[model samples]
Target: MAVPRRVVIVGAGLAGASAAGALRERGFDGEILLFGRERHRPYELPALSKEILLGNADEPAWVHDENAYADRDIRLHSATAVERVSLAGHSVLDSEGEEHRYDRLLLATGSHPRALRVPGSDLRGLHLLRTLDDSLALRTALRQAERVVVVGAGWIGCEVAAAARSHGAATTVVDPLPLPLRGSLGDEMGEVFRAVHAEQGVDWRLATAVAGFTGEDQLTGVVLTDGTEIPADMAVVGVGAAPRLGLAEQAGLILTNEVPGGGVAVDSTLRTSDPDVFAAGDIAAPDHPVHGRIRVEHWANAKDQGAHVAGNLLDAGQPYRAEPYFFTDQYELGMEYRGLADPRHDELVVRGDLGAREFIAFWLREGRVQAAMNVNWWDDGDALQALVDRHAEVDARQLRSGDLASLVP
Candidate 1:
């Protein structure tokens, strides 16, 4: 494949910034044009939930300074959204009725928060966290909120609940699952975090769904599906997010990942049905040789794929070879997870004391290490990742008692 003279990218987040950096570092010298819906520069999305919500907005979240993009001759068009991708002429139409031509196209549109659809959901005090503005607004609301009813105990919901509790607000987390993070950590391990939150005065309402909100123009309280009502001044919906693939869908690109808000299907090299069009970040469902077609919403995976896709654009010989990695932070516990293992199917094994909040867990299937997680571990993530990649048979007795570092080989 020859070098493209003009490359158009459809996202202005970390993934887009990282790709533009990679292209310049590799000495591509091409016209890299980036478009984003937000007016702000590319910043970290993970920080919006934690640091920004806690009023610690001083944290550096920008991927790079303006000088970095300017020095590389990259053109960034903020607050301009791409409406559709046309393959016939290799151009994209923007929201302002402008068309931009490109020799190569990349979609890093990322995702958006999934809104709750129930009676009274249109009321005020209902919030969804996705962008910086959403975080800022929610933070201001939490400062004055007396009681917060957090819907869905996923990562965002759990973290936001912790922040509200820190502000002396009575926090009630509602979820239909038996435990929080059950989809990722299974029942037993998920109980660990649940216990911590409970100890911190979080009212856990498991196996329950919200019937609706009760109020005229503002949320006065939340009514549960079982006819139980929880008083609240505000509610945060963190059920999950869906990929922003409207442009791809309109362009008739192949769609996969059956779940709502899934991703665009692509080959291992990140090429879509149209060879000139590619995808990266949360919007890409690249076919992994080991895990098949899966869309991972982890920050690390998106950043890595962004850089790798740039190389594929220059030379289409190499496939995306990195595995999935993710992390979560709540209260005193910090977790780093590696590999792709279904929590329901994998046999769970623990290595340290849950009481001390310091330990590592392994997800083994047929005696082969499929995935591993470290709680409160800062420097041991790479080792756990190695243990997962080795795919070696495990000795249960050794895994439970021996040092986790020894399992890497």
Candidate 2:
């Protein structure tokens, strides 16, 4: 089954598109069928929140041209919904109720924005940024949305806040955490990001909870848990995403209870409970040899996992071994983080000035560097990533010194 002659992939996000492209590059001449719910072909999602939202780019960065797919003999079904997949029957049923048999399958079905459950969430100006359409609509609304109230201060919220400010919107980002990015970068590094927002004039309502929305047909303002009302004409919720795993679960694939999406359990090579059925991207809590069982929700992980699955499906030998990597860009700040990043750390050692906006922070546990991140720095991301890879043993002094170079193994 190394060259499974017929292959079917569901969910046409970055992962699905990358898999299809990688299969061709891997020299697989098998007949491929790809399905996407969106009308447009697979595109780069990072642009949706970054370039497109800032009006720097008009169209999404498509993963492949229609002509290119046709050139590779890949039958890509855009705007076609795959209603259900049957592992027992070895077939997938489309919305039209047509069945397609496949020797192998991949569920690249990514996550969706966790919708806000407040009363006025149904209002016209309330939004969530997840897809291309969502970003486009939000960008259009930002043009006229003064006094914008952002409900979450995560990556999406921060980016949208930055974009709204660039368009002269009075932006305010709220989050329950004391520091904006505390959930990912730890408190010390999170304060750096929080200060950046404050420096840019973004009103920070940190450690505050949203009581509810206070408008009927259209969003007018946000009500805080303590009865303080923030006047607003629009709001964006970036509370993070929950994976979409209903299809895989319905197909009897085993799932991890602790993961956000009721994550589908996959082995090192990305094969799910059923060997013929595989999972990737946001929904997969893949068991990596180095990191153990973990789920990474980022563009790079999606792309890498997609490519990894294709190679594993062909040779069945290579393990999904690439270290988890992710990046974020907020206003003038840009960063790349690598290795295992657990938010529940007791301490992090910083090597540079936060006010100056150039730094490298390391999370260490018992003298072992668990993870590292670089912000607004040049050409040092790869070297920092190497330190995490080797679990380089270094004390807090070296990490906190201009001797940042010595920390690299």
Candidate 3:
């Protein structure tokens, strides 16, 4: 494969910005053009729910400064959305109706917050957290919100609930699930998270769906399916996120909508069906050597996959094998999880103390460690990750031995 003269990257989030930096670092002297739908330059999204919403930070975690991109010779177009992509013509059309040719194209378009289609979703005090501006706007509203209702028990919802309580709001989290984070962490670990939030004075309205919002011009209360109305002045809808794949779909790229990890389907090398075009971040569902085909929306995947695809863009011809990893912070609880495990079916074993919230929990299937999570327990990430990587069969008794090195075999 010949080196491309010009490379165009759509979406100026962490993945796109990381790819641009990796391209320059790997000695790619080609013209790099990065486009974003937001007015601000490329920044990390994790801080939006944590630091920015908590009023501990004023700015989004920028991936690179304005001058840094200029120094690297990367042309960044902020607030310029790529309206369409043409695989046959090898070009893309921006929102301004200008056509730009590219020898190689990378789609890191990321995902957007799933909307609540209830009746009063359009009310004044309803909010959805996704971008930097969304966080800032929600932060301003949270300050004066006396009663806040979060309509999801996922990471974003829990974090936003924590932020609301920090601001002295009577916060309540409502979800259809039986426990918080049950879909991801399963019931066993989800109970731990519920305890953490409950201890922080956050109320839970679980096992019930939201009927709709009640108010004329603004949100006054959240009505549950059982006809119980909880009084609230503010509401945040954070059920989950869906990958942005309109551009890729228009270009006729292969998608895996019927499969588990639905997104633009790519091969082992992160190359889409078109060959010349590639996808990464939350948009790319690549075939994994270890775990089959999967799509991860974590911050670690965006950072790692972006740089990994840069090498393949230069014809490195390597497959993506990075394990799934993510972290969450709410109140006094800080946790990191590695590997992918179906909590519903996997056998869970813990080391240390769950009551004290300082422990390492492992999810295993058929005696092999599938995933590991550490809550308020540091210094075991590398060892735990190694066990998962090796796919080593571990005895439940040995896992609680506090000696992770002995289980590597």
Candidate 4:
């Protein structure tokens, strides 16, 4: 048999580290080198804004230490980054002007948070939360500010608002959309989130767009599109993040189109146009088995996609297919969602009580189960997935009666 190829992975986040770990698990004796731009160990990002921000969890996010990598015989390089990629000859150039050659390369650079384009967005008190540094900076600024205005109704936006409220800061969430999580959970559930934050004493401003900033040096207030001025002590912008795809684009890789958000494109195998190069995490826009070519940014997606990339790199024989799955934790509430909703589905079945903070809603498209939302009752996730895969349709009564196991295929 031919010798195993060298594997070099970029971005040291969940995707990069998990990919390297999976490779060793699959008995790949090849030389594996993992590069991380950050000068620390790889840790989970989901807890950054929640547990880490609220001071509830203190353990490091890294699942393993340096000794683990050494034991596996994998090279883990920290405080280093791949400045550019020379696809013509499989290799990457680091920030120190050093070159490393590899037979297979995995790009998981992830993404950077999208910033506010307003004039005072660069003010000292203004902040964006995406990295550990951003979290620490925002945490400090929020403690000092008395009144805080948060822009955007996205997951991060709502989570930050909750965090700010926990710290006794007068908090307000302003979003152009009517509901905070309308993009992922649908408008109906979006209203649930709006009510949740409102009940917790957070100011929720819906269907309102920010016009401009009101300060010259530091953020003093904000201007709405209709000329409504709301004074603030500080501001946090959590709109979203733009995929870091400069290297991929420069390498002439095939770009995929994201309908609502602009993101990169890749095939089912997580491969760009260049066969040897693969991508995962936020930077990749692969065709979803159900959601078409859209990009979903969740911690689970990164871990799963990274595993797929690693499996495929072992040999040309194994190909990986991803099933979209994710979950969110806030306010002592756990919300789990599976599969993608079909745009054709207009009818929804509410099996449980949504108002009671415990319910399951299933989206149907052409008589097939497309997606589902499980609130509180987390045990039925596997049953829902099986029902979805089999396209089994049962009376809505069984779902509302807490007999979801009976609906399993």
Top TM-score prediction, candidate number? 3
**Tens-digit per-residue lDDT, 281-354, candidate 2:** 99989888888888989988999999889987776657788787888888999988887767585358878877
Best by lDDT: 3
Q: What is every candidate's alpha-carbon RMSD to the true fold?
A: 1.4, 1.6, 1.0, 2.2
TM-scores for every predicted model: 0.97, 0.96, 0.98, 0.93
Model 1, global lDDT: 0.87
Which scores higher on lDDT, 1 or 4? 1
Instruction: Give the clashing residue pairs of candidate 3, or none.
Output: none
- Computed on alpha carbons, the lDDT of every model, listed in order, comes to 0.87, 0.85, 0.93, 0.79
After superposing all C-alphas onto the true structure, candidate 2 shows an RMSD in angstroms of 1.6
Residue pairs in candidate 1 whose N, alpha carbon or C atoms collide under 3 angstroms: none
TM-score: model 1 vs. ground truth = 0.97
* Per-residue accuracy of model 3 over 1-409 as CA lDDT, tens digit each: 7889899999999999999999999999999999999999999999999999999999977888769999999999989999999898999999989999999999999999898888898899999999999999999999999999999999999999999999999999999999999988988799999999999999999999999999999889999998999999999999999999889999899899744447999998999999899999999998999888889999999999999999988889899999998999999999999999998899999999999999999999999999999999998887998998887798999999858977787
User: Residue 379's C-alpha lDDT in candidate 1?
Assistant: 68
